[model samples]
Target: MSIPTGDVPIGATVLALAEGATLTPVWANEIGGFTFRAQRADGTTRYIKYGPHNAEVSMFDEAERLSWANQYLRVPVVVQVGADHTHEWLVTEAIDGASAVDPRWIAEPRTAVTAIGRGLRRLHDALPVSECAWLWDPYSRIAGAEARGLTVPDRLRTPPSDDVLVVCHGDACAPNTLLDDAGNPIAHVDFGALGLGDRWSDIAVASMSTEWNYGPGYEDLLIEAYGVEPDRDRLAYYRDLWNAT
Candidate 1:
């Protein structure tokens, strides 16, 4: 996923959803979904995410997860959720902060990466595993990949033992964490796959994303910020699993 650049077409459905609010495209995902920031004349703000029907991503699932996580974490408040035969959409009340991968933060990798680490740790600590009803475990992920008709390597079928169970962000990449102007993480977004899983599942993905966004050598720093020693075996396994699925 990446921030949209240049002109992005505004669909009629999205236009109706905006209800005359000024809309600006903010995020474009690989699967063709677009997230827009909608600001009204009265100064209220909301985020609208719209996309075609895809089994791999579900706005309804995200809305549910966001509502559940909001009680324990700083996440967007779900305002509306709907789907038809061809498309699905979710509307959420705007929250304060910019994505860690925003251009402003991109220029400051240290701050962005550090905030992502701390933010991820906070998410894992805050969301209770016992209360969560979703699953992002290895078996589920592998099954999801197979359902998508992707081949998984035999080696990936066996995963490392769990270190600790927590409610994972599912997509813990840098872009998902939002940071305040002070370079501290205030909230996280994009919870379509949020569920209970091993903490390393998120740690591996978050640290690995640093390389994709900010470049190398910052992995250990993020791990340190998460207050954990590097578990080479778990990290390697999860990273490989992520690639496979």
Candidate 2:
């Protein structure tokens, strides 16, 4: 779909509240499906995210999930939510870090890859799965996407008959990972797709994304950092499915 533009109501409100607040756009693109930035005022900065869409199942739900995950995981904490005729917005406290795709990180692929891998492992190991209230099972996700007219890759439309479910960052692209100045991953973002699913569901997509976002030969580094051999079949399958969606 075309990217939405013009002033977003929710974003405008946050910017107004921080009346004299210094604000800089961090991400404003099509894929993220929202606009966000760092708002600084009085030496403190808050990460503000908002979209010019109805605060319905997707954006609002994600806002709730991210807010809740902060109580348990090292993710951003939502500070506010509001909606208007043109949009819905969620503001959150900013974490101290930069996107893993930053030039500093690009200059140190090994460090970036290692940090991402380790962080992924930590998330997979630490998130309290038994209690999370959502389920992003691939089968269900595929069905939902299809119902919404989102094309699904044939391979992913049918659920694999034999994979145990675990909590996964449904969209585990490298950019979603944030790193500290020291190159350590401090937190993750975009929990809209968080759910119970196969470990490979995440690993597969994340591994392939390394190549897409960072370039050649980095997939192995990410896999190594995650402490697993690459599952070529799963990676190929899921990567294709991800591209289709």
Q: Which candidate is the best by TM-score?
A: 1
Q: Which stretches of candidate 2 lie over 4 Å from their true place?
A: 1-11, 31-34, 54-57, 161-164
The 0-to-1 C-alpha lDDT of every candidate, in the order given, reads 0.93, 0.73
Q: Candidate 1 lDDT (Cα, whole model)?
A: 0.93
Give candidate 1 misplaced runs (Cα > 4 Å): none
Clash-forming residue pairs, model 2? 166-197
lDDT of 1 by residue, 204-228 (tens): 9999999999998899899999989
On a 0 to 1 TM-score scale, where does candidate 2 land against the true structure? Answer: 0.87
Backbone clashes per model, in order?
0, 1
Model 2: lDDT equals 0.73
Q: Write the per-residue lDDT of candidate 2 for residues 66-142, one digit (tens) a residue.
A: 87677767998777777777766667777889878777888888888888888888788877789788876767777
**TM-score, predicted candidate 1 vs. hidden true structure:** 0.98
Residue 50 lDDT (model 1) = 94
